[model samples]
Target: MMDIEKLQLHPAYRVVSDDLRQRIVRGEIQPGEPLPTESDLASRFGVHRSTIREGLRQLEQDGLVRRQGKKLLVAVPRNSDLASAAERALRMHQVTFGDVWQVASALEPLCAELAAQRITEAELAALALNIEQTAAHVAHGRSVVASTIEFQSLVAEATRNQALQLARAPVSLLMRAGYAAIAPALPQSGERLLEAHRHVFEALRQHDVEAAVGWTRKHLLDYRRGCEFAGLDLDLPIPLAMPADGPPK
Candidate 1:
């Protein structure tokens, strides 16, 4: 009576994909388990195999499924992988520097506190090496922006909290991008960055939670000052700077 036949319908492939996605999310299909063959899915859903292919493609894009040779499998995506994707989306949405910095200020200190308690010897050694490299880079008057980013990532990894690592990654990326944008004009900021990193590294290595948290908070504050010195406008949306070869890591 309401022109039912005139209503537009969603493609059959999307419907198939949504159904499969729900199954996967509900654990009907476990990670690392092979999906039914496209032919089987086509038969079961009363659709063409091509439609099943299209549906699987959507799941792949969403990081729910992966191909292992000739078979598709339910895949558990890594937190880092998911974070990288989120960072890209944030860039596309024109997230601002202030928006990122506010999140970092809250999460970073907690990450440091946890890392001080949980970091392994290997991670501590890595942090030490990073500090040495950053010192050398600053001494030679080279840009330490990349090293700075890596150092923070190492600290986050040391925390061993998957949720924290994932949540803070985009903020870390934004902080590095902001520094890269302004570091050229603020040469003295390199020394300050190096000092802050060293303090945080020392606290982490010693497993001093209070010191680690305090140093990390201080470092983040210093970053804000550096941005101000460089005259970066926090209110403006952060600029997206993708690598020449591929997407931002």
Candidate 2:
């Protein structure tokens, strides 16, 4: 017979959260639905109320539950929030600019291609506004890096595929870490970014899949070239620092 393995007991709070999280994921608990009272949960789980509270806190941080006044409601993790979590994980792992770009190049052109078919007028207007702001930033000699990154976010949102939107968000966040560092050495980058964004926006407006994808690919290539031009080592890890609250809005 095989020897019995040593028991490694997990925390009670983790056990509680794990059980509750499964229930929420399995749809037994639903979005906008209030969780049971803490006292009730403690009784059900045969744990102290403090234990239950700790467990619930984990769920809150996981974005599986939210507070509505005194009630805890089940919630879906927004793509943006999920992306922030992913960005943090990436930072901890010392993800490189090349790592980000490799994934982004795969996702971004596809995002624009999908948006050409699925984009809404509001999203188109958003992209237009981004380009407008980018142009202004360029004219005023202000950094356009953030606006360029935001334009990518807007394009990803326009795709309306939650999976794609969430997947691309963190990549965009990582790109910002590099963009801010490279901008000073590449003064013409802002105008180049504005031109690329405008071209893609027009393609999206005309529902031109090829042009949209083409311009997006060119734009991605431009980024790699910019990094090279700036003498940046693509292998260098992006800065681990993020905004205090999370990735920039």
Candidate 3:
């Protein structure tokens, strides 16, 4: 016979946190609005103030709540935050380069196509500056992988679509790692990267959607070629370095 009392129960704090999380997710508590006071939450949940604090802490860790002065507010997580979380999940699962490349190839061209239609003058200036810097890096015999990553990021930003920005961020992160791996082995890869970026920038500046998409597709294909030149096994899990404090710029 099984003992009914043998099962362990969840902590009171977790129960409170779960309930509050559901409320926030349901939009009962709107972002940027102050949450109930600790005293009020404790009383409503029939738990101790410490339990309420613990619950709120959990919410904060999950990026659902943030402290403002002495008050706690429901927070909308940023796209960068979501991307970082996705990056961590991918790293933990040992996602392969092929997996990342497939998604990137599909999404990046779309991003370029949309950016050609949506890009503003300010974004075009940024892309021009990025290409100049990338060319300088390449000419100086410096590693242009970081600049290349920024170039791609600028193009994505030019799209002005928050959904596309978030969707492609993890793929971009993985591609940066792939580029870093290949750039050292294939010296001409840097020059090729610069040329591709320049072509993409010109297409966007001219608002030529077909040209933008075509150039971006060619650029992505070059990435695979670079990997092959470097003798990188695409089927192997792509190694993930711990990212810096914020998302790619």
- Work out the TM-score per prediction: 0.86, 0.90, 0.85
**lDDT of candidate 1 vs native?**
0.85
Candidate 2 backbone clash number: 0
Question: How would you encode candidate 1's per-residue C-alpha lDDT over 139-182 as one tens digit per residue?
Answer: 99988888888998999999888888988987787677677755
lDDT of each: 0.85, 0.87, 0.86
Best by TM-score: 2
The better candidate by TM-score, 2 or 3, is 2
Writing each residue's lDDT as its tens digit, candidate 2 over 116-233 gives: 9999999989988888898999999998867887899988888889888888898897888667655777888888888888899999999999999999999989888888787778
Question: In candidate 2, which residue pairs get closer than 3 Å at backbone N, Cα or C atoms, i.e. clash?
Answer: none
| lDDT winner | 2
Error of 1 at 178 (Å): 0.6
Report the C-alpha displacement of residue 124, candidate 3, in angstroms.
0.6
Q: Global lDDT for candidate 3? A: 0.86
Where in model 3 is the C-alpha error above 4 Å? Answer: 1-13, 48-51, 240-249
